[model samples]
Target: MSLLVCESFLSIQGESSFAGRPCAFVRLTGCNLRCRWCDTTYAQEGGGTARSLDDVVAEVRASGLRLAEITGGEPLLQAETPELAARLAGLGLTVLVETNGSLDISVLPPEAVAIVDMKGPSSGEAERMDLANLARLRARDEVKFVLAGRADYQHMRELLPRIDTARNTVNVSPLFGALAPAELAAWMLADRLDARLNLQLHKLIWPPDARGV
Candidate 1:
């Protein structure tokens, strides 16, 4: 099977809990929602080089890294994504999938770790989140919230306790340049929130607009 792709390159893991680790990125094309603070709006299109499963695997493997992240404008938009993820896992590579929580993720392969991004109201696209996906998550999966300000943070803080954190890991990241990390950290400390803080390590290392790793 083939899939649309935006760009594929080897770079440091920028977000989530695995920040700063070397990773092979398969940035698939297209997204279902348009968030206000979206950094990768470039991925909102559906056209890109169409590569077969083997071709994609070869490109990732050639990077000489055993870690690959199948990220997207929203990867689950592609029907073959589960197959692609399984293929990558079959190669013994540690595979991680970054997905918007608005899609059904239950179809993905067992070995692939899911980094599910749960949209908050500040994103202006929170209603799209598929709440059912939360029930399907395993211990290898994680849920993330990207906060833009105090309102978003407060909303998420109230929602966190209702979520089953033991079934999956949870992460909270402030939108870069939109929210102060130190201030958000202080609030988290004060509330004694169980979530971990995440920073975009790649933006710290590379220019924000740069592509192709």
Candidate 2:
């Protein structure tokens, strides 16, 4: 079977707990939610390129990177995504699937880490998030909240109790350029939230809008 792929490259992972690690990325095309401050909107539509699972796995293998990420648009939008993640994991690669949290993440292979995004109020599509995914998180899985302001932070705080942070890594990523990292850090510190502040390292290493690493 083939997957609709947008682009794939090897670069430092820019988000999640795996940030800064050299990772091969497989960005699939299409998304169900339209977050207001969405980056990579270019992958939100279009058929992208149809690539066989073997071809995609071969490319990641050639990257010579031990870590690989299946990102989007919204990676889960494609039916073949879990298969891709499983394929990567079969190769003994540390696989991560970056999903928008609007879909059920339980479908991914246990070996593949899930970096699930929990849309906050500012994303405008927060209501679309599948709250059931909170209970489905695995120990190696991560849940991220991209906050734009105090309102979003509050939303995250309220939802924290529902998530088993002790089992899964919780990440709070302030919307780049929109909310100051220090501001979000202060809020987290004040509340003693059990979540790490995740920054987009790629934006710091290269131009904020540059693609393909």
The candidate maximizing TM-score is: 2
Q: Write down the lDDT of every candidate, Cα atoms only.
A: 0.87, 0.92
lDDT tens digits, residue span 88-141, model 1: 898899899999989988989999999999888989988888877877887788
Put down candidate 2 lDDT per residue, 1-213, tens digits, no spaces: 999999988899989889999999999999999999998999999968999999999999988899999999999988899999999999999999999999999999899999999998888999999999999999899999999999999898888998888889998988989999999999989998899999889988999999887
Cα deviation of 2, candidate 2, in Å: 0.4
Candidate 2 C-alpha RMSD relative to the actual structure:
0.8
TM-score of 1: 0.95
Candidate 2: worst 10 consecutive residues by lDDT? 157-166
Clashing pairs in 2: none
Q: Which candidate is the best by lDDT?
A: 2
